[model samples]
Target: MRPDPQETAPAKKQRRYWHRTDWLSLFSGLLFIGIGVRYLVEPPPNTGVMVLTLVFGLGFAGFFAVVSRAFRKR
Candidate 1:
């Protein structure tokens, strides 16, 4: 089929810059890892610290999972 000789197709859209967004993810991952490592090095004497350590460790694991998926898609 041949038609619409005078019609034009739409132009492609340009993606916005996102390099700065990478820093946020990096900082969050690092922060969680740091807290986890700190807890590993010095066992928390208090129950609150123990709970925080477990949460941050889980957070670090979750961060890696998300980052890996994002990188794979990219």
Candidate 2:
């Protein structure tokens, strides 16, 4: 005889630690903060410099994310 569907137990969801870290949001927030700080400076930074800094920040954030994921996997 077939078992009743309602009698079946629900599957438990697998939890992941990485889900807690919103990397995109973190990166965007940092970018906004940097732009705000740039405005606060007496002499506005050169556009090239600002772009370079943002690129560097992105690289750092990416590296951090990779390291975090690796550690979390352990």
Candidate 3:
């Protein structure tokens, strides 16, 4: 069957707002990694500095990964 020319507009994909969030996530992750490394190397005594750094590093890295995936095309 022949389709009508007037009804044949190509579908347009919706744009996402992931670019800004992606960069923010990446930067935050790197910062966390740096802080984590620093804390791990010279952690404060009687405090959970090392544990906190590790948690921040892991969480930020995971968030960055998800954001990067979302904005892969950008």
Candidate 4:
């Protein structure tokens, strides 16, 4: 059967600069990075801040890397 001329093709899903699901990922990533930076800028009140800095810094970096990979253009 031939397709109806009146019916148009379904729209293709285009990836935007920021996708809905990625919103939290992106926000968390930035938040962690900010926290990490704060740790670095402020003097270490205790040894825990050092660890916090490392974890958050690395976590955000990895998160951004993964997001970037997923969003890479073909």
Best by lDDT: 2
TM-score of each: 0.38, 0.59, 0.38, 0.38
* Global lDDT scores for all candidate models: 0.68, 0.79, 0.68, 0.68
Clashes of 3: 0
Question: Residue by residue across 9-38, what tens digits does model 1's lDDT show?
Answer: 566689897543454466567766876787
Whose TM-score is greatest here? 2
* Backbone clashes counted, model 1: 0
Alpha-carbon runs more than 4 Å astray in model 2: 1-19
Q: Candidate 1, overall lDDT? A: 0.68
Query: Candidate 2, residue 66: CA error in Å?
Result: 0.9
In model 4, the Cα lDDT at residue 45 comes to 60
Residue pairs in candidate 1 whose N, alpha carbon or C atoms collide under 3 angstroms: none
In the range 1-74, model 3's lDDT, one tens digit per residue, is 99987689776788886534555566666776776676688755445765676677677777767777777757
Worst 10-residue lDDT window for candidate 1 reads: 18-27
